[model samples]
Target: MKKKIVFYVRNLEFHAISKNLQTIVNSLDKKNFEITIIVGEKKYSDFILDNFSKEIKIKFILNDFLTSFRSKKYKKNFKNKIFLDFIKLFLNLKSIYEIKKNNFDTFIDYQGMYLSDFLKYTSIKNKITVLHENRYIGITNDKKRKKIKKKFKNYNKIIFLAKEQTNDFKLLYPDLKDRFFNIYNCFDINKIKELSMEKFTFDEIKWVDNKNYGLMLSRLENGKDFQTVLNALGELKKIDKLNFNFYFLGEGSLKSFLEKEIKNLNLEDNVFLLGNKTNPYKWIKKSNFVIMTSHSEGLNNVIIESLILEKIVIANKFKYGAEEILQNKYGFLFNNENYLELVNILKKITKENKKSTDYFPEIKKSYSRFSSINILEEFNKIL
Candidate 1:
């Protein structure tokens, strides 16, 4: 009999976790596993759901009636915190009821935040939670750390995207060492290849055709360290090495700040903030380099995609993110503290004008581990 697996997410926003969950669910072997997704809330752009295969089941815990209570207008009109708490309580209970009713063989909490609570109540033999971000962030308080450790006690396995992330977690919580597992995120390599060939047109394509443009495929947010990127660009300008354009492909609350900073740094001509796109692989295919300057990440999806497309990548040397993926073998890593290092790397790339094709042979071998078959084997081991 096929094993029944269900994944829980608070919502399906346009981010790596949701996208990875969609890819993994779709890529799983249908003959061996039956997949279902349960979302806690509904949103206007749940586009991630549309990518799933027809065989995958999908549901929303908050039906229309429960969803109405979540509106800003409703909250403003009622102004009752108790009512909101009651709603959350009801939803949690309802979530437990619905999940237990499904009789799934395994429950995978994709976000690893709110859904982990269900592990205490559910008796599912296989309980797993996947942490998508650097868990060290925003949990400095001892009480909060203790609470997280306690909450994670009932989980069968706690999945981290990088081996270093797993190692760090074990160091932080030694008692939970046995529960930690590292499953590198999955990707649909074939699908990305096909999508990269799609004739998606952007107006600036011609302007950047002959220019050495770099692509940053991430949300324009503070944590992504756009400030550092802008600073590096400013340094490059001072040294007369700013010969290329850099484009950001995702949208976030930092768009206005980034625009202001770009003008402040006099990089208006060298920077473009293209809003999020349905398909970013085409952009990656067109760029000379892919850059990542995040303060921290579990495992950056763009870094992997850039390597898969064989584009030169320059990323911050985070202990668990870029360094783990690139290892300075497939891509370059610079000191996160020194913007000048990034500037120097950018200058080197512009002077060399080399594509990642220089290392395409090795990149292919390095990236083969992310194939669906290999990832499925990892999942089977955990399950």
Candidate 2:
């Protein structure tokens, strides 16, 4: 008998959770597993629909909270507050009914948010929730943390993205430690390799063929601490001549501020903000190495992508995933607070990393370990 599994998510944005879900559903064993994805948000990018398993089932429900809040008519009406509340009440009841109708053997919360409230109103058991980010951020409310801590008993298994994330959570809630499991975020290693070979349409970045250029594929957000890169570039100029030009590939609210800082540091020519790229693999392939200076992460995908492409990855211990992914074998990690250490390391590697041919085999092995097949197999063990 095929086990019915449903992956539940709040929204289908072009983020890690949606991508991981699509990869899992697209690659699941169709013979052994019957799959469905129920999205709470009404609309998602066609990119999502294109990537999801066409052979399986997918539904996008009108998330009333988001709909009601965004409705212009509701905002114009003086009674909008009460009207929105009524809409929310109707939608919640309807959504709960839809959820109860599905007789799934397992329900996976692809995004770690509050959905247990719906579970309380239904008889469905075997709820599994996966945490995909550094839980330390956006979880500072002591009351909310206590609520989540109390609710941990309701889940069958809580999956963490890294060993360190799991260990930290275990330390906090020793009682629920037995319910926790660790899983690496799956990377479509082969897909990335193929994409990296595609030719680039963007203008060529000016650089010497011999000097190593570092790629930073991340969102320009405060949590990421991108200022460290700028500060490091400024500091490198004072003492030693820096050889690398860094390219940032993602966008965020901090873009303008970062541009200003880069100008102030006189690094405008050295650092280029390429904004967001739907396909960054070609850029990844051309770069000499990759670097991440985030304060925390669940599992940095860029680091894995860099390794798969046979480029050296420089990162900090951050909070989680760094040490586990790098393991002192494939990449380098420096003090998160010490930008100087990052510069020194980058400088040293620029001098030493003349030939990457020797690192390709071992680096490729690291990527194969996190491929989609392994991810589905791990899920099958629990399902």
The candidate maximizing TM-score is: 1
Candidate 2 lDDT score relative to the true structure: 0.76
TM-scores of the candidates are 0.92, 0.87
**Candidate 2 structure quality by residue, lDDT tens digits, 1-383:** 99888778867766666777777787788898898887766656567677776677877667555654644453455587777677666655666666678878787877874565666776667788888886543587889888887667667798998888898888877888989899888877788899898866635544424546778888777768687777888888667776678888888889899889889988876788878777778888888888888888888888888888888788887887888888877777888878888888777777776545454346656777788877767877777
Where model 2 places Cα greater than 4 Å from the true spot, the runs are 63-94, 136-145, 202-212, 240-242, 356-361
lDDT (Cα atoms) of all candidates against the true structure: 0.81, 0.76
The candidate scoring highest on lDDT is 1
Model 2 clashing-pair count: 0
What lDDT tens digits, residue by residue, belong to model 1 across residues 45-158? 546767779999888888766676665444443556778777788777777787898899998888875766666677798888888887554577999998888878868799
Estimate the TM-score for candidate 2.
0.87
Superposition-based RMSD of candidate 2 using all C-alpha atoms, in angstroms: 3.6
